[model samples]
Target: MFGDGEHDDGPRVHQQRSEGPGGQSAQQHQTHLDSIFMLLEENIVTFVKNELKKIQTVLTSDYPECLESQREDEEVLDGEDEEQRSSREAFLNISLHFLRSMKQEELAERLQSSKSI
Candidate 1:
């Protein structure tokens, strides 16, 4: 999913910052991660709000319960917001992958401490 014009340069291009003292604690770290996910969902919701206006125009007066049934005559839009969920998953995956890759032993120790909770 990297888009056009996207570049990582190199892993060393950007130094990862250690989370603050609050994130050092198990409960606080979970809370920090939750907050990040919440923000990402909020942003996705905002995007959906904008997109909905365009979808409404395309959907016109008639709406169908089933997407498959509508596909032949109308544009089938996903009623359930899946983009937000995918965005959150992508964010978490990237964060965890980076932590596990470069900081291997350190990340393992931290995750082990938090796993019980």
Candidate 2:
């Protein structure tokens, strides 16, 4: 903690940076938390774009399956830390309505049923 209405996130953030390459700031790390959904959504869009060229009917269920096999930091989600996995699940839960609002009802439903998506 600090004065002047400022605060410190403390040593975990500091330790994360220590484990990585030099000079990576805490805000750089915060980006991973903030961009999880956006990054996942971008990956979905890429899959859809590729699938469109190969076939007509793209099954929404395929996304979550494909997504489960995807990786971060050169490691698959199966190897992900608890914090990251929990963050991802929480984000998916929060984004379900957004998924439906975007006309992705089937995708939303599939993710809702899956523990990891």
Candidate 3:
């Protein structure tokens, strides 16, 4: 079917029929399979998009919490002393690390769910 110069933008299947008491033509069976595959693909795409939206929502909601916590930590380290600067840097690093871990976990869960599908 490749390079047939037909410019058909559809699924292609081999046309080989099986003879049986109640059987469908090879073309008919292939068409049915193609339809089923196309439907399945669309469903998968929709599911992934939905999952991504959920992830986005979760991230958006979590953002304010992150910012608030950072602000609180900074308030606690109000002094410009060396110890306070060091503590602030440490807190920022830890916060960044925690956020990265949370994002990684979310992505891993998403991938696991997609694999299940």
Candidate 4:
């Protein structure tokens, strides 16, 4: 009864290699996996852009004034608001504006690149 089944491991191995799922080969399965990876990468980049926009709206808002007032002694707001703070306030505001603008430009470039690809 067991004689035919125990003939050898060669044909069993060959059969396994030649069949997958309903019987697609290994190369066909790899193409599907590659496409899934590309789609996932695209989704992650989109999520980052949306989250950054939300944060940008909050940071550049008048909420900074209220937030700064609370941290007056901690130096967190040491030179943030111009009319209220010292001479350094204007420079700080300008510096923050430049940095934010640079970040936005970089984000735009990345989004454009992703779309182009």
Question: What Cα-based lDDT does every candidate model obtain?
Answer: 0.52, 0.56, 0.54, 0.50
Model 1 misplaced stretches (Cα beyond 4 Å): 1-23, 60-117
Using lDDT as the measure, name the better of candidate 1 and candidate 2.
Answer: 2
Cα lDDT tens digits, model 3, 7-110, are 87565544545653358766678888899999999986785565444334434444675555445444644645886556434543444456468777664454
lDDT of 2: 0.56
Enumerate clash totals for all models, in the order shown.
0, 0, 0, 0
Q: Which candidate is the best by TM-score?
A: 3
lDDT of 4 by residue, 1-117 (tens): 566667544556645675455677877777777898999899856855643443343343346664443344336434446654443334334434665577866544443333111
Worst 10 residues of 2 by lDDT: 52-61
Candidate with the larger TM-score of 2 and 4: 4
lDDT of 1 by residue, 1-117 (tens): 568879777777246545666547556787888999999999877865644443333333244543344353233333335875475345445545666788665653453343111
Residue 103 shift from truth in candidate 1, angstroms: 50
lDDT of 2 by residue, 4-73 (tens): 8887666685355433235666677567656987898998778555434222112332565544334332
Candidate scoring better on TM-score of 1 and 2: 2
Candidate achieving the largest lDDT:
2
Please state the error at residue 83 of candidate 3 in Å.
53
Instruction: Rate residue 97 of model 3 by lDDT.
Output: 57
